[model samples]
Target: MIMYTAGDVRVEERPDPKIIEPTDAIIRLTATCICGSDLWPYRGVEPADHTAMGHEYVGVVEAVGDDVRNVKVGDFVVGSFVISDNTCEICRSGYQSGCVHREFVAGTIGTQAEKARIPHADGTLVPTPGQPDEDLIPSLLAASDVLGTGWYGAVAAEAGPGRTVAVVGDGAVGLMAVLAAKQLGAERIIAMSRHPDRQELARFYGATDIVEERGDAGVARVKELTDGLGAHSVVEAVGTQESTMQAINSTRPGGRLGFVGVNYDVTIPGIDLFFAGIHVEGGPAPVRRFLPELIQLIWDRKIDPGRVFDLALPLDEAAQGYKVMDERRATKVLLTL
Candidate 1:
């Protein structure tokens, strides 16, 4: 799939990818998904400039460079959106997304096609325990991005036993954060959403409460649930000025806030954060750090993260996948090859 401009995506035959670096690998994609970040360009919030689209993918390794040791041809693999050498100081420090030798997969070549070339293959790709069942493909594919991102959000927010965790936004990431919070043993999980379908999914993901309000009213509801002390942790999954403030104000003083939303026109007020006395930590999630554990959970059928993909289409209808997601008609769209 290629994006010539906002709202204009096409399925065209692109040249087959080849191993360009000693650490590179070529993958034949079995599954890919349209991410929330992809909407930035789809809605014209960011420039497309005829760029290739898609980052989340699960596929079979077709070939690997001589230097690649961890993965080889015919291995069913999942990789992070950001390629990392996994030996750089930043990557070793658990920030692979910001590694010294990092390159975003979408910027180089798209996965929403028959094939894609992955750089730093050994460090970036994780092989599954074995070939996954047909039904498990969607869940495993989700581990490539959204599920890992939400897990990072919950961890960064310090959601755990005895903590009251509140999540802002009910998108795929937010819903996944609810699952993470539940898995982490959060005492109370409050999901703020007005959409019935998402609210149901949040509840299924272990959200104990729901706040149908937004902005200040939503913040008030969260405080009320927390006995006026606010929540112990807050996950901000919608990147907007209002959502950011909602997450900040909904947390207790000295609490932590994890923001994983793909920020658009967002600006954080220095004074408000200082007075709030909260610790905020977030960026593109270092998905590589969590891939192993997440893969195991999916393989064992402990979590069904694929529930986020409400729409599935063949690769040829890539444009429709973008359309439904942009219009909020689908929680997430899965493209099958």
Candidate 2:
């Protein structure tokens, strides 16, 4: 949004993003989305004014600069929320999310519009097998953000066979986290959701347990399901003080806590963590690192993350999509160009 407000997003015509560097490439957005994280910016929690909005996108490349090589014109691609060049040291280390020259492209590259200019095109965008079928677009788009974030949470939390995982929050990210944990082979997944709709989807996505409580009560319920030892891994998808604490407390001693929530004022109690001996890790999930494999899964129709999107709108109705998500009337909203 060019202009920002506390409860609303305003869309206006502005300069279209173009290749500004040799590493840049421009793609015509075929599908883009309003991410849960976008709520933070829309609520005036992030620097809003004069910033472009959106990051997740599925599109066909329109042009590439001199240095761009990994992608080509007419190639259908899915871009990561964060931009990076793939050849960097960090990218090779499986941490493209933390690339040395990583740039937050949401409000700048702005996938929300009809066209987006991607910096470090080689690293930031992954080409799909072919022009995705109509039904595959949404699932592929989800991989660019929510699905990727959730998958990263599962990976970070060490969700796998014989392990019990607890996820805090029931938003799109949280619900997707449940799916990710299940796909990662977690024996049991405890999804913390008070919303009946979300809880239902959690089960569809492979949640073995559903806890309707929050805060300490939720943690207690999680422990109850895990033989009073707490979950082997905890995924924190909500970037709030309460959710963060729940994730931390729900993990057993020496367990891992994978948090993808964008922390604001949420503080981790040093003393409590010191005593718990929990291994806490995660920030902005390096979704790009996992895009190739995730894309393959979607292309094969092996997993359907499109289920998380409860609302869909055309690009012109972008404002309404934001309203649906901000008011919690919808879990995730998909915007079509």
Candidate 3:
């Protein structure tokens, strides 16, 4: 898929991608999805002049460069949106997304097509235990981005036993954070969402409570649920001034806040953060660091993150996929080849 301009996307027959670097690999995509972040371009929040679209993908390796060793042709693989050499000091430090050699795999080359070229193949792509069944494809694709991001949010918030974790968004990432908090053994999980469908999914993902309110009222409800101390940890998955304040204010002093939302016009007040006394941390998730464990959980049927894809369409209808997601008509849209 290609975006000629804002609010415009098209499926075109482009020249097949080739291995440009010694560490490159070519993949035949089986599935890809429209991300909440993609909306930034779709809604004209960012400029897109003949740019390729999409980042989340799951596919079969068609070819690999001579330097590639970890995976070979015919291997089913998943990769993070950020390409890393995995040998840099940053990658060794468990922050592959910040590797000394890193590239965002969207604008230069996109995955929302029949084929895509991946640089740093050995370090970026993780081959699955085997070719997953059709039913597992969406879940595997989720692991490529959203699931890993959500897991990172929970971990960054320090969710664990005896802690009360609160999630401040109902998108795919927030719902998955609820799952992560549950898996991490949080004593209680509170999901803030007014949408009934998402609230039900949050409960299924182990949320112990739901706050239908927003702004100050929502923060008050969170405090009430946590005995006025606020939550021990808060995951901010919606990037807006309102959501950011809601997450920070809903946390107890000294509590940790993990913000994974892609900020648009949101800004953090220095004074409020200093006075709140909350530890804040978040950025582009180092998904490569969590891919192995997350892939295993999906393979073992321990989690079903694919439920986030409420709409699935063929790759040809890429425009419609973007449309539904932009309108909030679908939690997520999956494009099948």
Candidate 1, 1-337: lDDT as tens digits = 9999888999998889999899999999999999999999888898897889999999999999999999989999999999989998999999999999888887467888889999999999999988889999999999898999999999999999999999999999999999999999999999999999999999999999999999999999999998899999999999999999999999899999999998878998899999999999999999999999999999999999999899999989989989898889999999999
Q: How does candidate 1 fare on TM-score?
A: 0.99
Candidate 2, residues 44-138, lDDT tens digits: the string is 78767766788889999999999998899999999899988878899899888899989987776677888888888998999998998999999
List runs of model 2 lying over 4 Å from the truth: none
Q: What is the C-alpha lDDT of each candidate?
A: 0.93, 0.89, 0.94
How does candidate 3 fare on TM-score?
Answer: 0.99
- What are the models' TM-scores? 0.99, 0.97, 0.99
Which candidate number maximizes lDDT?
A: 3
Clash count, predicted structure 1: 0
Task: Pick out the ten consecutive residues of candidate 2 with the lowest summed lDDT.
Answer: 1-10
CA displacement after TM-score superposition, residue 295 of candidate 2 (Å): 0.3
Return whichever of 1 and 2 wins on TM-score.
1
